[model samples]
Target: MVVTALDLVLAGLVVGFGALVQGAVGFGMALLATPLLALIDPAWVPVPILVPAMVLAIASLLRERGHADWRGVGWAMLGRLPGTFAGVALVVLLSPRAFAAAVGVVVLACVAVSLAPLRVRPTPPLLVTAGLVAGVSGTAAAIGGPPVALLYQSASGPRIRATLAAFFAAGTLLSLAGLGVGGAVTVDGLLHGLLLVPFLAAGFWLSGPARVLIDRGGTRPAVLGLSAAAALLLLGQAVLG
Candidate 1:
């Protein structure tokens, strides 16, 4: 498939904005960017998007390395192993429309849980479960942050961002490896991802200011709102397509 200039421009903007959100709130890039990128070009999902997401994760992690919860990340990584395989299977088995719809459902469910008054502690078992869910969603749809982010909604902004960054930085590699083994990775996807790197960098840089506002009691709302909006858009696309 030939990608037009307009496609690249639009995708760059989407990725840049998603990066800004993730950089500020700790886990929104994929949730906000994936459906739109899929609309721009279905081939941009998963591999291409995961590339930039991984880069942003590393950047975010380094910026707040001191605040990360390594124990939580370790537990999450444990579950990510099996979940990634499941996500790879879905990619190989489902049609694009079905996959999109499934992702929409999962995201919406996560958002609903996040909005409820239930308080969740990041216990080892819960972290592992969230990691498993995140692995499947992140690998299949490039929107893994919500499950894990939801677990840290009430935490300090730096901790939330740093911990998620650690998880995604490592988790994305696992997903990419699974995709490559499943034959979902392609040269075109890698090239497209590289093309979007500058945008990701720009967005991450701009997020410095936004981080202040978000840290002052804005994290939970941003995470829940962005997740819901993106999920709705994805569902609409699936239905329309």
Candidate 2:
């Protein structure tokens, strides 16, 4: 791919905003990236978004040591591994249009589930089930937050944000590995993902100061609004697509 000045500038801006969303709410990279990038080549969306979000998460961790339940994340990842293989296999078998359509519809579904009025704390079965959803969504769309985000309680804001950040990072790493094992992720994917790390870091830098009071309840409306808009955009695209 050509390293045009415009590409860096545009990608930088997108990544910066993505970091702010992630920094502020601890999730939203793919939620923010997908609907926006679908305006360009929808196929170009996932890796770039993941690259920045991963970096943003890394940067967010620098502010304070966000304690992550490594055990929970591991269990979730274990459940997702097989599903990740399934997703990669599905991706390999599907056309770009078909993949995009499926991703859009499923993203909308995750949004609905995350925002459901009847909230239920996840049990062992449910957590593993959510992991499956995370794997499929992450593999298909690089947008996996809604599934596992629902697993965290909003009241426990610190744990919610910290754990979700860890989960997002873990999910991406797992999916990236799956893509490699399945021969879906190419050298270009890895190279591109690494190359975008600077933009991701820059995004995190811009959002650094804002992390001070990120746990406030005020952020929910905006998060949900962006999510709802993304879902609606994805839904429309899926239908018309």
lDDT string, candidate 1, 103-167, tens digits: 77977887787777788778999889889988887887777887788788889999999999999
Best-fitting candidate, scored by TM-score: 1
All candidates: TM-score: 0.92, 0.82
Predictions in order: lDDT: 0.87, 0.65
| Candidate 2 residue pairs in clash (backbone atoms < 3 Å) | none
Measured on C-alpha atoms, candidate 1 has an lDDT of 0.87
Off by over 4 Å in 1: 95-103
Cα lDDT of model 2 overall?
A: 0.65
Query: In candidate 2, residue 35 scores what lDDT?
Result: 62
N/CA/C clash count, model 1: 0
Q: Kindly give the stretch of ten consecutive residues in candidate 1 with the minimal lDDT sum.
A: 225-234
Model 1 residue 32 CA deviation (Å) reads 1.9
